[model samples]
Target chain A: MTPLPDAPAAPTAPRQPARRLRRFSRAERWVHRGTAWLMGICVFTAACLYLPPLSELVGRRRLVVTVHEWSGLMLPAPLIAGMFFRALRADLSRLNRFGRHDWHWLRTVLRKRSKEGVPAGKFNAGQKLYSAFIAGAVLVMIGTGLLMWFTHLAPVLWRTGATFVHDWLALLLAAGITGHVWMASKDPEARLGMRTGSVASWWARREHSLWKPDDKD
Target chain B: MEEPRVDDAPDDPGEENERHGAPVGRRVVLGMLGLGAAGVALGSHVQDRIDAVLAEVSAKDPTGVTGLLPGGGGFRYYSVTSSVPKRNAENYRLTVGGLVDRPMTYRLADLQAMPQQRLVHDVQCVTGWRVPKTAFSGVRLSALLAASGVRPEATAIRFDCFDGAYTESLTLQQARRSDVMVALTMQDKPVTHAHGGPVRLYAAPMYFYKSAKWLSGITLTKSVEPGYWEKLGYDVDAWVGKSNGRSDDPTS
Candidate 1:
């Protein structure tokens, strides 16, 4: 066979050390963990309060009510405190501002299409949507919870509506949280990021290629 | 002037739509509309079914679970005893004694003969349910105490239910509240056996547990005594919002 001209050398990108990237700040991790714990208590105690079988099993309605009310009331404490952290604030802002890519990402996810080439920033569309939903749901819970606790302040119609919304939204939130836990458990890197505030650079590059670290880092 | 770059930006929905060629937005809107319609229809249907089931179950439920379920307009049927002894106008007698100068007994007809005070108040339970605007008409408990000649040292009032298993108590001040009554009729009808009838104590601001059902005895006492639930760790005071370390709003 005739010898072919030597193939031109393929252009190569510069290689960098596989260092740990700051996936979350200390404040962000703390708030996430604190919110998780408080929400867990709120959900657990609520189940004990609402479900007859669970209530009977638990057998301390008064204590459960106190815990449920207080924990639900305090659900937004960490998020409120997190407002002071610049990184967390920026992250929240990013989560709130949805772009066209978010819809595309959602469609791809729903359609069960390959996620390999989908463009996503620090948080994927699902995470951003979850954050927005959870933040709003927490506010709704707090409002309705306060109304239910201070039963006489609002009219009967308002109380009834609040109770309905509170109950249904709680079930929805529980389902969402279960799905979230399942997703987190499947991804050790994501869990590690929330726990330790850092993740492998390669993992970040692969999963969230469009992500750019904050300048202060 | 700098023109906004559109080629590489991921936010260009027009470009993305061109590539995908599917009306995903329209589909989503349609899907949401369908789901919302389904939800409304299903919600109303489910609620109707639940109401029907509750009505049926409340009518016959022995454990009081159906009654305890929220959103019943009329009085719920509840009894601590497995079988409540039914008393009518002929057989029922309420005794007023203990720490009083003049102990007396009144028949059902005698109670009906007394001045009747009608109250429309919410009945709040310790378990966080409230039945609103419940109409209870009966003789004022304060009137009974006054007639019995309560002694100066009397600090509380104890109640006994004819059920023989249930008892409740209240502080004398609580007992003498204008809203407190020995309820004979509920919802404009004679109190049914299922609803602590023949006579039931109505303590408007207190939890329902303090409103002793099938009330057969009222005793003025020297000290505040804990009632059935109170003995089982419920607050003795039993005030809707103030007692039990809870801040629930008072139904009254």
Candidate 2:
């Protein structure tokens, strides 16, 4: 699938045409894909955790609970390990920054305007914000999760407070992640880039203007 | 959607059973509707009815009965059936059986006479609220299961509570967690009646419901049987930060 953005300007490149190189190494890609799938598993599991009548379908409540805990414990492992990669770290850092455009995008979202006209970047403001929020929230969840995991290390009060923060934030994060995934799915080019590791020049320029490769004059 | 707890969350959503009655909100509506069809619809505020119900519980045991008393550390109290009256150390008996080589019966004193463990941890309810830093003391569930000589084939352990309103089951592996205890004391002193005593299973890492208040029986089975809330709709595991309707922080 391709986007029909306005006609592309002729290339002025006097140097070799920019070709996409491996940004995320194979290990990094595996980590990313693994985590994405896991997030889905965790969220789905979390949803079932709330359903009062879930045990009959799931079987033993004890087993269901143990699965949930271990899955959660595993969720952050990939992310934390992936954070050590240079490219991933750089991407994450770039995605974390909030600038003038993000504020505008926020206003646009609040006003219920379409995203069609927005000038985007490596990650549009909303994407960046979503990434950061989820990153922070997941870390909080892991930290608090460990506290309630055992009686030592964390005091009971901390565990209680952490419980409130962990669950509420997870709800908020789940809702936000759902919306983010939905919106991102609209652009097949964006999906292609992540899946196949490349995007056509026009597609890149139209959507990720800030991240579009520099042209040779 | 991938079910996290495949054992508890069967692929089909329609077949689940919950232990804690139906969940709070929808169950009320459904219950009232079922009641109304019988021609006696109470046209009143639900809050009033809930209060009236609470009032009745308070009235039944004015001085507090066994497994109904709030402990020294400011604990919450709830009862399932109004008539189960209070029981104390002298009157309580805990039975262990089901798929086991030895079915052991213990007086409250006998259990207390076994080595005890005390833990200070957060007690999280699946609903939403939390009581923090709750101190509880009792014997480890692992020790008891071993004492009863659990069969090699045993897979799940079920808990039967004295209140009759509550029952919980744990995977044998889960029951062996070092933190899992059958609690006798909350906050330093002996757990008063309202707090699930002479003993309640204190599965610290799981949701409070999994703790199984007023615990009276333990049955080790080869497979799983849904606990009270599990029969209704709640996730069977009831672990803190994982299986509860709201996966809050972990209860370490």
Candidate 3:
């Protein structure tokens, strides 16, 4: 091919490197990971406590109970600690709000329609919903768990109600987390964002179109 | 490709206000925590109401799920029957009969007046809650058996309850163990009515269920008869750590 026309002269201007957008702060990532680890322990220990086969298999029942209780009691610690970080506070503010776009996004998601370029911020509508539910669930679980732990603090019916709610809600939470994991597995870019606190600029634009990374970050 | 630029953030007033505001949400959470503490502090009225509701629910809940959760303390209240009549010093009587030289009915005071033994042992429930180092004082079953003069033909001891439902048994050898007693006081106080009080059996080496509650009678038998829970598939020989397919540390 005539040596590709002697290789036309390359442009003199320096090409800018592809940018990496900051998706999560270090504080946010640590909070997420810490909460995840504690939640994992809680779930595992709860399974060992409730399931007969598991309970029998893991014979140190008293230790299992102690681990489960302490892990559950510590679930809120990371989130509460994250409040001191401005970035996390800003993100929490974002998560707590439900804008017109968010409602539309939710409606479209429920309709099973294309969600391409849905104008999600740092977090999507699904993520916002998940955060709300998880926050509420964590609080409720802690309250009920406290009642279960300090058995003498509450009466028979309250403890009964707490157990009933705790058991059923825990099942729901486990299911929700399974779905959350499945979604995370499907999106390697999102997983990278959570893991590294950053994502490719193009990916951010395509996914969280409304997200505006702070220059200071 | 067009260069994407950062947009001015905190666009929404709600988000802006939440970021700048004095963390009202966190305050709400802290307030809830405080309210929970207060609820526990002033829970007597709530306790009564809850107990009333529990009684109603217990009447209807056949599975006894209502009774499975731990009560005020660590103990789970399990009554096989729908309701147990409350027994106290005025009406409580423990009868020792069957295969004995002298069958005798004794009042609560008589047992209290007899030589008393105190035991501090872990109370283990087969379903798996333990109250460690619990103090129980009562007349030993062996002492009562010796007083009644158990006949030579008797091989086992059967326990009866005022609840009209629960029953328990122990081999003659098990009944004679120094650890086993007819528990009169628990935690240094007269066993409350809720705790199978006025009088109850306390088998220190066995599970709490084996310590028959609302104890009413002690009968000598020719063979070992399984107790109420034993009939329902619990181990007949429910020695902590050694029986019931479990290996937990022995309570004694």
Candidate 4:
């Protein structure tokens, strides 16, 4: 997709209609989509494994287990690969910074009368928190999952503990993802931004008031 | 004169009896009924039903996913082959031959009629998981060997299963351990097919793989023969604590 310059629409025109601004770059969208696909397979196979009724219906527990394990092992691959992309690195830095407005945004966004969101950058506080949780969760799940799959590598007590942690953390992660999806549904612009790597300039101006289309690393 | 007072007395004694005796009698009856209900609830019949349900569920799950979760003694159903041929009492047979003075064949009924030894031991799998205090009852392997009269040249006993793929062996010394048996019952009930029932070997001191399931033949060999899993890199002597390079507690 061709990116438009943020220059004033036309010198002859007094005021311009809303423009499309770059939100997620092509590399960022690729990373996000790839991670989502792998995580989806992991979740589906995990359901087949953890639910007895579903296991019976599926009748290929071995295959489900193999798919779950491999997908989980590969969960961080996209993020690692995307580090080479300059745009993704820049976006990651933006996600890492937490400004005063973010804390204010988190505090006031839930209030009944707070229609206009607190000024945010390319990423908001909630998004950052979610990203942090997911990153930590993926690491923990992979560690415990490896202990379970490779029982010979650890003691019985360690393996047992791993199983316990793996099972419980999976439930929490699932709930967190559900909330993430719910929040995403509320902002179609954000979803479209992820999909097409651009968002309506007016939408960005309202949600991420501090973001500028011309800003670059 | 005394007989006149003996008539149904409506006195303090009778009132006291009425006050305490009726409720106490009712309570005793209720207590007895509660005990009876408990006995039935914890009885073999309920245990049998539980075993059946577990077997049915595990059977439906080929990968033994249920075994990964806690409960039901943590036993994973493992079979080397995709499908195992089912053996029942009417069709089941055990042949003891090879390097024996008297080759003998026994039916399910014959094995049941022999003296049975019951064992309560933990079942440890090589892949890691222990089901503690599982009960297995059957004729002792030593008894079977003695009856067949082992030949002087025989040094090991190789056991075969109706599953058609599995074979396990133990040294004559190991086989003669009082703990080893040809198991007919498990968990206080006839072993369900899912758990390898009717007749199977029980090597109490070794990893469960040594206790071959769906056992069909017993051959006395001149030397120790590695069994199914052993051929695939599992230790031939799968003693719980001493073998398999694992330091887990012994099944015994």
lDDT of each: 0.73, 0.63, 0.76, 0.74
- Give the runs in model 4 whose Cα sits over 4 Å from its true position: A1-26, A33-72, A101-126, A141-217, B1-87, B90-110, B126-128, B147-149, B157-169, B198-200, B213-222, B228-233
Worst 10 residues of 1 chain A by lDDT: A1-10
Residue-level lDDT for A162 in candidate 3: 62
**Strongest candidate by DockQ:** 1
lDDT of 4 by residue, A143-206 (tens): 7788767767766556555654566567778899998898799989889999998888889878
Off by over 4 Å in 3: A1-17, B1-252
Interface RMSD of each: 11.2, 23.1, 11.9, 29.3
* Candidate 1 Cα deviation (angstroms), residue A194: 0.4
lDDT of 4 by residue, B139-221 (tens): 99999999999999999989998877888999999999999999999998998876788888999999999999889999999
Flag regions of model 1 displaced more than 4 Å.
A1-18, A113-117, A215-217, B1-252
TM-score of structure candidate 4 = 0.63
Task: Provide the DockQ value for model 2.
Answer: 0.01
Model 4 achieves a DockQ score of: 0.01
Error of 4 at A201 (Å): 6.8
User: TM-score-based ranking, best first?
Assistant: 4, 1, 3, 2
Q: Note the residue pairs that clash in candidate 3.
A: none
TM-score of the candidate numbered 3?
0.51
Per-residue lDDT, model 2, residue B212, is 81
